[model samples]
Target: MILYPAIDLKDGKAVRLLRGDMDKATVFNDDPAAQALEFVAAGCEWLHLVDLNGAFAGEPVNAAAVEAILSQSKTPAQLGGGIRDMATIERWLDKGLARVILGTVAVENPALVREAAAAFPGKIAVGIDARDGRVATKGWAEVTDVDAVELAKSYEDAGVAAIIYTDINRDGAMQGPNIEATAALARAVTIPVIASGGVSSLKDLKDLRDCGAALNGAISGRALYDGALDLKEALKALAG
Candidate 1:
């Protein structure tokens, strides 16, 4: 499974938020582009970026920081947040984003997800952030009655490149991923599922890898920043 080092942007700085709480954000790096370079140097194949402010604002608030990272690194990156419309999707893709993950729109306007997937093929992905198995949107500010698995299955034929499943409750808590739920979601869908949130160690990575279901990859933020998960060691372990 691919390990995606996360660079969540809040006010143009790299930060990690606890349980999706914006008020509890802890800044990691002031120079996000430099952080991207550091991750690339550590042998990360892909980077995961989230525009924390943009997600709540419904517009690309950290565009400059994202562009800086893109310009500095050759590693292909996938980005989510503030990307709601076709024009915004097209703009980010043209600006060097390898993939565009549609989150809130996936629940509110699935037709757009279908249209974008049709238009961009493998460049589109669905991000399902959940609390208690119910999908959350608008940067986790609102929770919906949508079942994560059912929503994932709904996009089975949409040609979505992957489904990024994040369990918000465990996020940044260093508790480890919800392996059972993530694995089940992966099993229930033919489309690849990338696990996100609460990934705290190499063992966690191994568990996800050996979970008996095919996971596309996993995304981690706080663990890497706090030295809970050594990126170099984790990459070596995953490589094995």
Candidate 2:
């Protein structure tokens, strides 16, 4: 499993939001590109980035920051937030984003997901952020009754690269990931599932690795920033 270091952008700075709350953000780095290079130097295989401002505004709010990271690092990065259209999707992919994650659009306009997945082929991923097992969208500001598993299964043949499953309640809480829920979702579909949110320690990474489900990998944020989890140690642990 790949340990994807997360770089969440808020107001052009790298920050982490507790439980997806905008008001509860903690800025970690001012230069996101330098941060990406640091993670790359630390041996992270992939980088997971989110545009907090873009997710709320429905457009690329942190494009400059994202572009900077892309230019600085050769490591493949996947990004989510404020990408709800074909043009934006194409723009990001054209500018070197290895993959583009569709969240709100996956819930609001699933056809776009299908179209993008088919058009890009192994470059489109669906980010299913859920609370209490129901999918949340628009940066987790709105909750829906849509069942997470069913939605994932619906896209079973959509040719999506992966499903990034995040549990909102645990995000940035340092409580650990929802292993059972994430494993179940992975087992329910053929497309790869990447667990996100929480992911507090090396044990959590080990737990996810040994969860017995065919998960693609996992994404983590605050813990790495706060030193609760050492990047080199966690990477080595997962390497086993």
Candidate 3:
């Protein structure tokens, strides 16, 4: 398991939300690029970034902050939120993002997912944020009737790199990840699934590592920021 460290940007600052609520966000860093470097310094293999503002605005809002991170860190990073079109996808990739995660478009415009996947191959990933197993879009502000597994399965042949499955309720709650749900999603689809939200401890990382679904990784934000989970320790545990 890769143990991706998350950097959620809101108004150009690093923050973690309570159940995806924009107003409930708690800022952790004044400089997102500095936070990205901290994760890199601790030897994280990959970074998971979400533009909270962009997700809500449906366009890149934290572009400067994200670019600042890319400029400072050499570690490969994957980003999601507010990226709804081909032009935006191409722009981020060209700006040195290792992967562009398509979430809302994966539900609203699956054809775009296919087109982007075909165009970028391993550079594209689908983010499935679920609330009670139904997909939530537009920064988790809108919930849809679409089943997460079915959506992921639809892209089985799309050649997208991975599926980032996040349990919205568990996100930033520090209540631990929904291992069974994430594992089930991984088993239900051919795409690699990365678990996100509420990953709070070293044991949580181990649980995901041994979850038996061949997860690509698990994302942790609040835990690391609050010192509940040490990045180097979690990375070592996952590596072991």
Q: Rank the candidates by lDDT, best first.
A: 1, 2, 3
Candidate 1, residue 93: how far the Cα is off, in Å: 0.5
Clashing pairs in 2: none
Residue-level lDDT of model 3, residues 1-240, one tens digit each, is: 898999999999999999999999999999999999999999999999999999999999999999999999999999998999999999999999999999999999999999999999899999999999999999999999999889889999899999999999999899999999999999998889999988999999999988889999999999999999999988887777
**Candidate 3 segments whose C-alpha is farther than 4 A from its true place:** none
Give a tens-digit lDDT track for model 2, residues 1-240.
999999999999999999999999999999999999989999999999999999999999999999999999999999999999999999999999999999999999999999999999999999999999999999999999999999999999899999999999999999999999999999999999999999999989989999999788999899989999999999888887
> Which of the predicted structures, 1 or 3, would earn the higher lDDT when compared with the native?
1
Best by lDDT: 1
Which candidate, 2 or 3, has the higher lDDT?
2
Q: Candidate 2, 94: how far from true, in Å? A: 0.6
Stretches of candidate 2 exceeding 4 Å from the true structure: none
Worst 10 residues of 3 by lDDT: 231-240
Cα-based TM-score, every candidate: 0.99, 0.99, 0.99
Clash pairs (backbone) in predicted model 3: none
Q: Which stretches of candidate 1 lie over 4 Å from their true place?
A: none
